[model samples]
Target chain A: MTRARPLITDLLGGLVVTAIGVAGFVESWRMPRFAERHADPFTVPGLTPGLLCAVLTVLGVALILRAMAGRGGAVAIPILEWPAGSAQRMIFTIASVFLYGFVLFGNVPFLIATGAFIFIFTIGAELLNADRELGLLPLGVGALVLAIVAAFAIRFIFVSVFLVRLPG
Target chain B: MDGFFQFLHAVVAIGLSADLFVVVWATLLGIVIGMIPGLTATLGVALVTTLTFTMEQNTAILVLICVYIGAIYGGGRTAILLNIPGTPANAASALDGFPLAKQGRAGEAMAVATTGSFLGSIVGMLGLAIIAPWLAEFALDFTSFEFFWLAVFGIVLCGQLTAMDDPLKGWIAGFFGLLVAMVGQESLHAYARFSYGISDLEGGFGLLPVLVGAFGCAEVFVVMRQEATHLVASKVGNVLGSALSSFRYAKTWLRSGAIGTFMGVVPGVGEDMGAWVSYAAAKRASKNPEEYGKGSTEGLLAAETGNNAAVPGALIPVLTLAIPGSAPAAVLLAAMIIHGLRPGPLIMITQADFFYSVVAMVFWASCAMLVLGLLLTRPLLYVLKVRREWLMGAIFVLCVVGSYAIAGRIFDVWVMIAFGLIGFLMRETGFPVAPMILGVVLGPILDNNLRRSLSISQGDPLQFVSRPISMVIAALVLAIILFSLPPVQRALGLVLSRLPSLSRKNGDA
Candidate 1:
């Protein structure tokens, strides 16, 4: 209905860009130019990154100025208010993804971790839906069946057909 | 003539090979993937790229091309049945497509879309087969300085074209991607520039993981954050009749296909723009323009054909110039590099028949799509009914596998997650991700060439302007920048507007 203001997001994003640019500039400047090896100044490893850093800093300042002037840029990230219970679902999904990739992966058995991830994620998503009536039994059973089929299919394709090695 | 006949022989051989089955199956899978709401053609191709790592290069390339063609054509299914586009390219189709569906002619609309896509692909294939090698031949004269300018031109033009409202944001995203590529050890010198002592960072971020994260994982997050909509279905019609009827408006097909192919050849301008522009042109030329938004088969055909034709259009630059014409083409370019099939000016001379093989692949993919798109329209629509809960879960699994399978490294998976988060945030803030992806793809080329050119010129900045090819490219880049300025554009518009009257007065004299 109403337009969400992007002022805060733009301001924050500009600051982040400016910070990254500054860091990039400093780190690039510190990099060895290896002048003794008779390398051309233009071919110095830091040249492109350093140039990009300066450009990024300038753009960030421009973004900040536009935001301060009340002109349209990134006003506000609507992450907080996509729909009822959306923010929670998004956060949950992201966390589950990270956990699957980082913590569970390489540490646990490949099939078990993948199967559990699919099952839990599916059930978790259904449980988090605010508008739906949660049916635990069907949801659990469905998640289980889908996860088994998916995990096996993935293994068959990647491990068998494609010959990619999955870690336990 | 000899080369052409050889090309035909190769095509015949490939046609009879077992890989034809791969093409058929990949097309069907691509259609199903395209019909899904959260899935995109770019992601489909990227996922397939990971899967193709172990296959023979030719078979792998065949599958990827089929998937690419199928997915782009298949997005029309949702655009017609639901008011939602399965991908950004299908957005234009949804305008007239949904109306046709609501009128209980959904099958007719699907049939028209399939026919339009087939015709568009045919036209684009012709362009690729004819024009691309010529362009590559011409580009053989390009020097280091010319390449530097071309790279900059690509980034700037891409930023401006993809995000008209905020070209600044697009430029920033593009530059950021370039910076990301600048990480790890330098190619010219072994100096570690941005690694900061992290061993994993030394190799830089692999393109596959970042792509999977940005397109795949980010999609998962975006989909999960929204409530799913219900699907609507319609009955069948004579597929041949609906397809043949599109020929009644042959002019629309020709115009739209031309526009789509041309748009595809332009570096970074892609199918979404092709569809929108073609739809607008068709509406403008129509005798009954009022029917455009209310179930006009011509409008639907224009959109579908334009987007699909752009597919070949996008590949033109990738095959000849090593610059991608679209996001999906970006992945395709990456796939080429992964398969050791380098695409650039030297490609024609080094691997002469590679160009013909690509053309053959496009031709086969289009034929496969025509068959599958018409026959399996309803079954593909059935995929739209699959719940978001299950689909997103499956996608996440694929993302994890696709990212890790590239290098069998866990860090790449983390990279995917990180980029996915960044992509999600960037999308929410209206920064276009395509330019950023291009930046990463082109960053090394830009850096290596710029340094080489400057080094060759002994740090003479004027060398960039003095060299003929570089000067021309530099002028084009400058022209693009100037035209992007509102004041300059207005002044140019004024001059252009007075030209007709001035011409008329001269004619009278």
Candidate 2:
């Protein structure tokens, strides 16, 4: 029964997906009536629910079969398991990327933001590995150099040559 | 004869100008990008595509073609040296190439790969020149039913071929990709399907963001989790000596070239499939099949030759039929359209000199690949010594920049990050990423054509079966599905094995 829980979970997942797909078909069927009132007649005429319904039906049938065959459960198979603390590192990385996009883009400028992102990320990766012997100075310097070189080269090509406008 | 002279004249004209220098430089830049892990041939082409938008059509075409050739060949370098394939197309190469590197024959492996690539490109070009018209005629016969089946077949085949141990994961991954492709407005009409009231989703997911996120950012996250800081470095050796050894396995080169061209002609399948199929076939045919994954030069040669050949092979459909055989070919087709050139049946009649000029471009691109590959071998080898952490980090930044620069939208950057997470999760599970990429690239084609065909048929379900070409394609699709069944495959294999022997005996008698 303990081993069977995974199979049950997969079955439930498949069922949920099928239900969603069926709901989509139903929703699409109702959409034309609503769209007709709000939208132009030219647009609503082409947005037929038949095609959407057919696609959903097909997908639902496929999913049901896959679940019945015990195939849906197989997607959870792990090739390489992440180490403990890896989740934290991934979260931090994602946060850093978001910061680099939102906060860094406008304030720090492109080259500086790019350099900082590289430097911080490399250091963070090293710290996550928990390798103290390597030290931060060399890695930081190397990353800065690489980031500068890359940023300038990209600017030269994309901006100077191609004349694409980049965020300063 | 006059056309031939004009062809030669165009070739000479381009060859003498700064356009030739641009081609050379582009080829070198492409090689550098390709040799680095996470920078793929597709990305190289896509990035260069935007740059070439401002240039003259002929010069743009030449630069892009040279880059395409150089990048495809360049991926083999990292595969042989670092054991991490620079692109998915090089995955098969890494199987035997890395083993050869470990055996202190890294230089030899690189050389063999280079020679095989050169030979393979030439063979593919010849095929393009000689058989493109006939092939295009055949392709024109393909309609909506055929395209839908082709897209499905590509996804299924890629999944089955890539995932050696499990096919289920492949299908799931592929379906997931299809679902992702479905998020935007339907192609037949601008009706939103899964926009969820979000204005940004109106355009659907951008290809550049999805690609960068999947391959680039995901790779960085995966690498960051690993314990190793630096890639294991191998001693470099004589590249020329290894190239000479490639000639010893001439049969492998020829076989792979044929396989590559065949795979490339099939719409939606590309260099990755070419490499996989060629590698598999070479292994099966070789006396030393067991040595394939253990650094056999034959395996490396087959993989490299197949992928490089696929570069020119992909262009055949684009030049002749106006239909792209692969994703990069689709971009190339778009570029052609932008240049006021429509490639189809009438192209040869309408623009005979332009047709010859494309042929000339391919030839020059091949020559450029050979020269750049040999000259840059030593310096490029040093790149393999870079720490994995640094390399991965640098690539992540490039991915961000590349994704953001595509549309200059913050939404695209977020999309990249989101897809990167999804790609990472998918990798942790058993899903193959190639099918997903294929789905995204081919989704609109399948959707638009299927809807158009149905409209033409007035919603008649049997319309696909009624058309002769569509009927043939439907039968082929059915045949492929039936062939995948174990019992059917075994029976077919038994029959196939006996036929060759019977034919040989009959010939001898």
Candidate 3:
């Protein structure tokens, strides 16, 4: 993409970092010192976190100033550089994940929730793949079978064998 | 002499027992995990740690150690067959290995990797056995001042090395982790700092949940976001023959093993650097440097050897000082504590036998990796072909359960998702996640020692720089920050640029 993408990221990220630093410092400073209990002054609970937040605030300012000077480079990790034309797919995945984790997981029965999640995720992802060979009906059939086996097998192993006591 | 017998006894005890079954299966599982493009050794070891919660202490450590060693070695298979490295440690292997595969020499590349990995593990095992006791003895002299400085030194050095181009972001992530650690109760007064009357916040974030989210859950998003990969080579030609002939590259593996072990000993640097530096070093010393990146066996061997050697090398600090040398080692250290075994300073005096048992575990795991890698080379290719569409759903499910299993708390699952999003954002913005995890691991050590030392010295800042060891560590931390500055780096680049010309002129004269 364009060089300006990282520049924008840096600008936004710098602001968030500064915000977190400022808020963290205020919270740390508000912590009790235990002076009333005759505790050691040097061992006050606020001292270490306050110092860390102050340092963080300085670094955040540096990042913002560097971005303002137009000196930040593009994202450097090669593995993290995602290819383009996948926005629709990404949105689908994230939405499905949020639905599963936030709404479905703890609210429904374990097997039903897990199996339905796997089925929907598989069918949805396969439909998004342009190179797919399977028809939709066949894909759904396969996904249903796979999801059932996986849900039962995982529940049996974790709950019966390892004895984890998984949530609803 | 006595140590040798202790090591020998430990080896035989494990060798003749039913633990051999556990060793092979754990290593095989590790190999499968590493062969998957999105699965990292850290995530593999962390998830397996959940499975070992009810296991006996030493047995649990044995299984984790096997998984750790096996996973690092297993990633080389993906590097050769597919262009993608299974784990970051095998990124260097992908350079020469994919080329070799394209040339119909994939079997040879796999053979070279297996032999090289085994040799590297042996060298690192020797280093661990010989050096750990002495290091533990030296650490006994460390007081709170030294520990405080040590903690700072780890964070700064790790941040600098992992993100040298952008040390500012690395340090920020580390400090943020430390701030996250401060949310729980303070040890001195037991007064919660940032809990805000929430009962769950008083307990702080669980390390496993954060780790699983950052590495495991984040990986699911990253995998689904990227374009899919394919395996390029299907033919497994004469693997055993190439395996026998790969022994001729002795000098390359030996050198790479030593280099990898050194990198592993450096906190937070880990196996990725071990592979890269070893590959570069091998290329420089090669008779035909042009052959590199064009299917050079020496380069592939060096990469594999270097990465595997770092495994045992990373263990030294974990056993001796309770400081992990890498991310996966960080999980192993946490697993040690969760299993009720303490590591640091007094290990040699109190837990010497257990230390020897760990070395034996490494040795057996390396052997298991070699045997399994050769026998299952063909069958394992099926694993790489599994569609990400079908696989990621199950993987995310495991991530949720793994996080929940640690404490049976639904809040931890929420923590996992939160960190997963944060980790995804951090990666998108070019911030490395290793330093953040290292920061989490070192947080308590830094906080505890910082307050304790200050109380002892009654707020005399001079005391931090007064003792010899503490002063030396402080100086090192200063030097790292100074050298990371733009001006200092520019100056060094200029000087380094001139050195090559100066050397050439001297040779001509």
RMSD of each: 2.4, 4.9, 2.3
> What is model 1's DockQ versus the real complex?
0.67
List the TM values for chain B, per candidate: 0.95, 0.85, 0.96
Task: Please give me the DockQ of candidate 2 compared with the native complex.
Answer: 0.33
Models ranked on lDDT: 3, 1, 2
- Model 3 score (lDDT): 0.88
Top lDDT prediction, candidate number: 3
Candidate 2 per-residue C-alpha lDDT over B226-327 given as tens digits, one digit per residue, 9 for 90 to 100: 455234445566877667778888888999998998777665467888898899999999999988899898998999989888877888767775555665
**Clashes per model (N, Cα, C within 3 A):** 6, 0, 0
Give the per-residue lDDT of model 2 (tens digit) for A4-98.
Answer: 44455545544654665566556665544345356433234223333434544565466567557765454454434455767767777778777
Off by over 4 Å in 2: A1-27, A33-80, A85-89, A106-108, A129-134, A145-149, B1-10, B140-190, B226-234, B320-324, B327-355, B485-509
The deviation in Å at residue B316 for candidate 1 is 1.3
Q: List the residue pairs that clash in candidate 3.
A: none
Candidate 3 scores a C-alpha RMSD against the true structure in Å of 2.3
Q: For model 3, how does the per-residue alpha-carbon lDDT over A20-55 read when each residue is reduced to its tens digit?
A: 889989988888877788989888889888888898
lDDT of 1 by residue, B60-120 (tens): 8888889888889888998898787888889999999999888888888999999999999
Model 2, residue B468: C-alpha shift (Å): 1.6
* Segments of candidate 1 deviating more than 4 angstroms: A1-4, A73-81, A130-134, B489-509
Please give the TM-score that candidate 1 achieves against the real structure.
0.95
